[model samples]
Target: MTTFVTLTAYGLADGAVLALAALGFVLIYKATAVINFAQGEFLLVGAYTFYSSFVIFGLPVTVSVLNGVAIAVILGVAVERFVLRPLIGRSPISVIMVTIGLSAILTAIMQLIFGTEARAMPPVLPRGSIEILGATLPVQRLLVVVVAAVVLTAFTLFFRYSRHGVAMRAVADDQQAALTMGISVRRVFAMAWALAAVSALIAGVLLADITAVDPHIATFGLLVFPVVILGGLDSVPGTIVGGLTIGLIKMYTFGYLDPGLADVIPYIVLVLILLVRPYGLFGETRIERV
Candidate 1:
């Protein structure tokens, strides 16, 4: 029972990371209809930026985190203004291809600048364990869960009540209508990118704690796809629930299934979900009028 509890806690932590990353994915897709193949690269960049600022420069961890997030926001805005904005109203395939190209370019640039070697992230949380219900878990893991929850909650509230947040939702729903209503669709796109960047930063930092920083960090962004799909691309709460579901599924795979099954479980689940609930558990269904 204790083992199960421990695994559940760890799974929630992992899910939190997935949920946060997927939130960004959903945001960009919702607003701009871009899949953002480079999403993971943004995360990699943020992790490396944090490493450089804190681990290498010896700056305070808090300061480094702030700087890292700032860089991510700038990168997001730049990408939208330069790369994605130019392709607006173009073919979806073209936009997707551009994102793929952008991913490769970002990866190459980072490789040249940071090199291919894995770098370590400085520990942000205290190194210790907390006991709950007779289960011992790392303090950092709990922190990850708490931080993810807080971030997700804050974003939910922002989108629910804030003016800009409402504007974003309007843009996501119908860009043309949003524009007619005096909302700046372009600015909303940029803000979506900025928010995505921040999500990547948080994911990168938390993931860096568990995995070393390297080019492969970008791959972690891919994990967001299944979560987003499960939650429904347009549903934020669905994303959170989907993330937790996938996390628990992964944990069970690691525990009961063949050790190698962990890698395949997500795809399997994704396929099943698509077959059963094409729009996702909480995703809004589209109605077309001819």
Candidate 2:
């Protein structure tokens, strides 16, 4: 029972990271109708930025985080302006291909700059453990969970109440209509990318704390796909729930099931979910006019 409790708690921590990363992917998709294949590259950039700030520049932890986020936001906006905007209104396939190409480019660039070797990220939070219900969990894991909750809450409120958020949503729903209504669809697209970058930075930081910072960390971003699909591509709340579900499944599979089963559980769940509800649990159903 204690083992189960421990696994559950740790699973929640893992889910928190997955949710943040997936949220970024969903945000861009919701606003721009573009699936950013480069989303993982942005996470890698953030992890590297944070590492540089702390280890090379000798900056404080908070400053390192801020620098990482700032760099990611700038990179996101720049990519939107230079790469995405030019290809706007093109075929979705074209856009997806461009993003995939960009991902390769970014990965190459990171390798040139940071090398392929993994680097350790300085601990952002104090190292400690606390016992809860006879299960021990690292304080850092708890911090990750807390931070994820705060970010999700803030994002929800921003979208629900803020003017900029409303504009972004309007654009997402109907870019042509938004433009007709004087909302700068282009600007909204940029904002969506920027916000997604911010989320990536947070996820990168949490992941770096748990695992070493490296090019491979970008793979974690790909894991977000299951969460995004399960939660519904357009549903923010669904991301949270979906992330938790994936995390729990991972834990249970690793614990009770065969170790190899852990690797395939998320994909299995994703397939089953799509089979039942193609649009996802919280995703909106589209009706074709034709």
Candidate 3:
């Protein structure tokens, strides 16, 4: 019972981070019709940015977080403006390859800037444990879940009511119609990238706080694929559900099943989901007639 409680708590935290990363991926895909392979690099760069600011420069924690956000916005916009914007209307294969190339380049740059050594994440969250249902749960994990929920809620509201958010949604639904309606598709695209980066930045920081500041954080971003796939690539609400579900599955696998299975379970679920429902739980289905 204690073990179950602990695993559930940790799983929620993991799901929260996954949701953030997957949110970014879904945003870019929905708005720009592009699957950004560099999305994981966004997490990599953001985590290191925070690490560099606090550990290396000794900045205030608040300032360090803001710095991470700044870098994310800059990196996101720069990628969209310089690399992706020009490739608009090109072959999908070309765009996909370019994004893959971008990921490699970003990875290289990160390694060049910070050697491949793993480092401790700044212990920012409160350190302690709380007794819940006779189980001692880490405060950090609970805080992670809370923080992620708040951020995700804020984003949900932003998308629901904000003007720019509406515009982005409009563009996502139908780019041609949005363009005809006087919406700037280009700006929407840029905003999508920037927002995605920011979400990944926050997720990167949270996950690093739980684990460590390591190169593997970037690879962890790949997990977003399964989350988004499970939740529905273009469904915002689906991302959250998918993330939490996957997180719980992983934790349960780690606790009760073969621990090795935890790492691979999400992908396996992804494959099964594809076979059963290719559109995902909330994803829209489109039919075209020639």
| Candidate number with greatest lDDT | 3
After TM-score superposition, what is the CA distance of residue 44 in candidate 1 from its true location, in Å? 0.8
TM-score of each: 0.96, 0.96, 0.98
* Candidate 2, 1-290: lDDT as tens digits: 78898888878988998888888888899998899888888888888888889998999988888888889889989989999999976999999999999989988998999999999876887789999888888888888889999998999999999999999889889988998999998898899999999998888888888888889988877778889889999988889998888988898889998779987899888899899987888999999996
The digit string of per-residue lDDT tens for model 1 on 1-290 reads 77788888888988998898888888998888889888888888888888888888999988988999899899999999999888877999999999899889988998999899988765786669989889898888888889999999999999999999999999988888999999998999999999999998988888888767888988877878789889998888998999999988888788777769977898788999899998999999998999
**What would the TM-score be for candidate 1 when compared with the true structure?**
0.96
Task: Please report the candidate that would top TM-score against the real structure.
Answer: 3
lDDT, candidate 2, residue 227?
90
Task: Summarize candidate 3's per-residue lDDT along 146-171 as a digit string, tens digits.
Answer: 99999999999999999999999999
For residue 47, give model 1's deviation from the true position in Å: 0.6
| lDDT (0 to 1) per candidate | 0.88, 0.88, 0.92
Q: What TM-score does model 2 achieve against the real structure? A: 0.96
Of 1 and 3, the candidate ahead on TM-score is 3
Model 3 spans with C-alpha error above 4 angstroms: none
**Clashing residue pairs, candidate 3?**
none
Off by over 4 Å in 1: none
Worst 10 residues of 3 by lDDT: 115-124
